[model samples]
Target chain A: MAEIITVEHPEDPRLGDYTSLTDVELRRRREPAEGLFIAEGEKVVRRALAAGYRMRSMLLTPKWVEVMRDLIEAADAPVYQVDPALAEAVTGYHVHRGALASMQRKPLPDAAAVLAGAQRVAVMESVNDHTNIGAIFRSAAALGMDAVLLSPDCADPLYRRSVKVSMGAVFSVPYARLDPWPASLETLRQAGFQVLALTPSAQAEPIDRVAPHRMPRAALLLGAEGDGLSHRALAAADRLVRIPMAHDVDSLNVGAAAAVAFYAVAHGRPGE
Target chain B: MAEIITVEHPEDPRLGDYTSLTDVELRRRREPAEGLFIAEGEKVVRRALAAGYRMRSMLLTPKWVEVMRDLIEAADAPVYQVDPALAEAVTGYHVHRGALASMQRKPLPDAAAVLAGAQRVAVMESVNDHTNIGAIFRSAAALGMDAVLLSPDCADPLYRRSVKVSMGAVFSVPYARLDPWPASLETLRQAGFQVLALTPSAQAEPIDRVAPHRMPRAALLLGAEGDGLSHRALAAADRLVRIPMAHDVDSLNVGAAAAVAFYAVAHGRPGE
Candidate 1:
């Protein structure tokens, strides 16, 4: 069972991990360096714990303590019950969902390991938006895509906003950053995966026409919102695919596009 | 030619339509009541005008005056030139986007009218998040879905955040609020449409299994994120369709789900 402590002072040194929560750049640097990431609200906190992530500690308002009693009873970490005002003071935002947990982040799995037996995978390049990262993880997990491979510049999938937006699916969908980016894509190709770059270019074949599931394995590569796939990344892909657009609309946001592309790879051309 | 009028004060009554924009409830009531909606940033403002929405006025920082010279030369509306500080003071947030426009809201087209010649459409129920609304509109437009029909409870697609998020695709896609709830859904059926309710229920047919385009006309019905399709809406649907999620994932965010569903309806089961 966890040890419960009551904290009155907002300046408590033990609460350091939760401080400066809203400072994006600082937290981005400090969290990874400190080997910790935060999960906000009851849902995300519960999910992180359920995913086998070790809890460093938990901070909760009095009301949420009873709400998260099951987790409290099973956890080995210390629990600090603090005033809502103190939580706001420490996190620099209102703790409206009433609970936050700081969890020890696990080392990223080797990309080859995640790809070894995987049939469908998503590869993101320079998708730096945290929300897009979260949304894509959620779709990849739900659509039964086996795993995710990120370019070096993709945002952290375990970031607080990403965890909340993904409803913790980031934990279920295994992912690793591909270090050398375009060249590192060789990892998937060597694993018998057909790497397809998703683009809005007219010259690319429509995604449905590709029927990716017919291949022994497939990886769908996506890029940032405006610039799309880098020229080098596009050249690295085995084939270029597109979701046919209409009405002169520019393109779907990367998150939406990822969902559609994931679904196409998963089930659009069944009976392969 | 647009009249360029310099406004030195944030308190000027001429800026009424642009005030308290970050306040969701107030802007929700005010923008619609005044038969006006706001468009933020350069791309969205340009799309709004191209969609034939009359500009009541344009507010731009001095630097953007030359940037929007063509618009100024073409519009008869007044352009208020304000300092950066005054723009923030009036809108309650940073005006980093540098331009804002108040555009007249056209009367919503009748649901039957939008469905008359449409092959594919999206029906949203209680999807109150402006971001989801915007994302859905964007996907619907790009995926070649003809129009959108919203439950009266759904968020306004023309809301400033929605407009900006959709990249002004909301202006290109025709939409109308379906009054009288599920009863108004009858309007689609009466127009010879197959209404398919999208749910995450395991027993529901996989979305790809239902080739909507093979039908004479089709409407894909979606619900909000957490609590999806109400009992009554499900009962009203001609068929219940699902996306077949894996990994014990609860559900996809409604926005992502809508994109996949729209593509399934638009491009799935070709040559059927």
Candidate 2:
């Protein structure tokens, strides 16, 4: 069982990880140990615990501690019980969910390790939006994608907003950032994975045409919303595919497009 | 040609329609005439103008006046050219886009009118998130969905955030509120449309199986994120359809699901 600590002061040094959060930009720039990645709500906290992340501590209102005793008992970290008002004061917002867990982010797995036995994978480049990153993780988890590979410029999937938006699915989906993009993509190709770039260019084949049966191990590459894949990334892909859209319409949001692509690829293969 | 009006005072009554926008709740509750809908940036303003939404007035910096000369020249309403700071002061935010348009709220089209001559439509229930509402419109426009039918509890699609998030697709897509709850759903069935409620229920049929080719006029219904379609709305549907998900995942965001459902139903259909 984890230790139970009662917190009375809002400025407790142990609660340093939860400070300055309203200034999200500064908080994001803070060094990892002090900055801390927070998972809010019972469901997300539980997911963090189950995913083998090293939990620093849990802060919860007394009522929540009683209500979520089972979940609290399962955690190997300490639990801090605070008054709801103190909890709100420390967090700089009204956390109605009453439970939050801070976890040390694990070292990212290597791209090759993530893709070794994977059948379907998503490769994202310059997707800087945290909500979109979280949504893509949720979809990838639900649509049977074996793993996700991110470019260095992508948003942090373990960010607070990403964790909340993903409903904790970010903890379940295995992902790693490729150090040298476009060049790093060669690793997937060398492993016999077909790298398919999704673009709006007319030359790209429709997504349905390149069914899952044709490519057992596939990497679906996506780009940012306004500007698509870089020339280097496009050149690196083995083939280009697009979701056929209505004339005069531009494109779906990156997150929505990821879900559609995951479903298309996963639906084609039954029990991979 | 639009009459160019110069306003020197931030308190000018002419700017009443453009103030107090940071307070979203208050802005949402503002009377249509007192709180005109704001369309920002060049593209959205052009779409609003083309939609015949009765432009009340426009505020633009000198740069926008020159950059958007063609669109401004095409409008029949007054255009106020203000300095960037003055525009920001009147609008309560940094008007970085330099162009904003306010339009009178036209009466919503009749539900039947929106449905008439439509082969594909999305029926929404209790989808209160403005961003989700906007994203659904964007997807509907991109996937060739002919109309969007909303329940009484749905958020206003013309809200500033919705308009911005939809990338002005809300101006292009037709929508109307459906009163009388599930009873209003019968109108679609009466018109020989198949009403398919999107849910994660085990009994629901997979969405791909009910493709657009199989149904003449299909209405894909969606609900709020946490709580799916209300029992009444589900009961009203002719059938229940689900986007197949992988193990342990509950569902996707309503907006993402709408895109996938729209694509599954609208793909390869003639004239779509």
Candidate 3:
């Protein structure tokens, strides 16, 4: 069980992690080295607990402490009980969701380890938008994709906005970063996975026609919304598939397109 | 051809339709009883033009007007050219896109009208987030879903944020409101459509097993993120189907889920 502490001062030193969050540059500068990330609302806080993230502390109003008692008790951190107004003042926002948790960020698994036993996976390159990252995780989790592998340029999956947009699925879906770009893709191929690059190019095969049984393990590679996959990444793929789109439509948003592709590849697999 | 009009004053009465947009209440109040909606950025403006919405007027910076010569020449409304700084001052924010257009809103098409000749369609109920509404439109268009029909509570598909988020596909997709709640769903069945309600319930059939060819027309019924479809709407469908989700996952965001469902229903058919 976690210790319950009462805090009245808005400028308490313990609350520093939650302060000035709207200042993007300051938050980014402090976040990475500090190894801390914030999870807001009851759903995400519960997920943080379930994911085995080491909780540092929690801030909540008395009402939420009661409502979320099961979750607070499951945490190993101190739960700071504060007045709603004081909590709002400390956090620099209204804090209407009533509860928040701060946890130590976990290191991602190795890309090879993430693909070792996976049947279907999503590989992202240069997807910098946090909301898109979150939404893709939510889709990957809901559609039963085995794991998500990211290139170095991808946004932090644990970013506050990503966590909120993913509706807590970021905690459940396993993801890891792959360094050295297209060279690292060889790790997936070594594990007998077919890397299918998703593109809008006319020469690509339609996604549905690819037989499921031929490739027991598959990786669906996606890129950023506008520029799409880099030339190097496209060249490295085992095959390229296009989700046939209407004329004059540029492409689907990266995240939404990922969901469609994930479903097409992951669907109908046994045990799902 | 659009007549060019020079506007020097930020508070000019002619700019009333484009002013106070950041104020939600004021903007809502100014909305035409049937047709007042805003479209932002050059691409969405072009889509709006292609969709045949009667443009009330356009506000553009000199740089944008020069760049969009072809689009401006195709417009039927007056083009008001202003300096970038003045345009920002009038709109209450930095107008980075350098262009905006106001259009008279159109009446929600009758559900029957939108469903006519449609093989695959999405029916939304209480999916009120504007960005989600826009994303669904983008997915529906890209995946070849023919139309989107909204329940009365759904957000305005033509809202500026929706237009921008949908990548302007909201302007192209046909949509109408279904009043009288679940009762309106009967209209779809009468049109030789089998209404498939998307739910996460364990008892529902897996989406992949759904026979697409048996029904010449199908409507996918989706709901908001949290509450999902109301009990009444769920009860109205011909059959319930679920996307096979992984362990401990609750659901995808309604918009993302809509994309997967749309792709499955549209692409699952025997022939393209």
Write one digit per residue (lDDT tens) for candidate 2, span A1-272: 77789999999988877776567787677735454688888888877878888888888888898877886677777899899888888888888899888888888889989888988999999999888889999888887888999999998888888889888889888898898877999889888899999998999988877774357788999998889899999998999998888788768888778888887777642222
Summed backbone clashes in each candidate are 0, 0, 3
Docking class of 2: acceptable
Error of 3 at A99 (Å): 2.1
Candidate scoring better on TM-score of 2 and 3: 3
lDDT string, candidate 3, B1-272, tens digits: 89889999999988877887777666655675535888898878877878888889999999898877887788778899999888888988888899888888877779899888998889999988888898889998888888888888888787777888898888788888888788999989988889999999888888877755345898999989889988999999999998877778868778778888887777643343
Tell me the TM-score of each prediction against the true structure: 0.97, 0.92, 0.93
Model 3: DockQ score: 0.59
> Comparing 1 and 3 by lDDT, which wins?
1
TM (chain A) per model: 0.98, 0.93, 0.93
Candidate 2 residue A40 C-alpha distance from true site, Å: 1.6
- Colliding pairs, model 3: B35-B104, B35-B105, B36-B105
Give the CA lDDT, 0 to 100, for residue B45 in model 1: 91
* lDDT on C-alpha atoms for all candidate structures: 0.90, 0.85, 0.84
Ranking by TM-score: 1, 3, 2
Q: Rank the candidates by DockQ, best first.
A: 1, 3, 2
lDDT of 3 at A110: 94
- lDDT winner: 1
Residue B221 in model 2: lDDT: 91
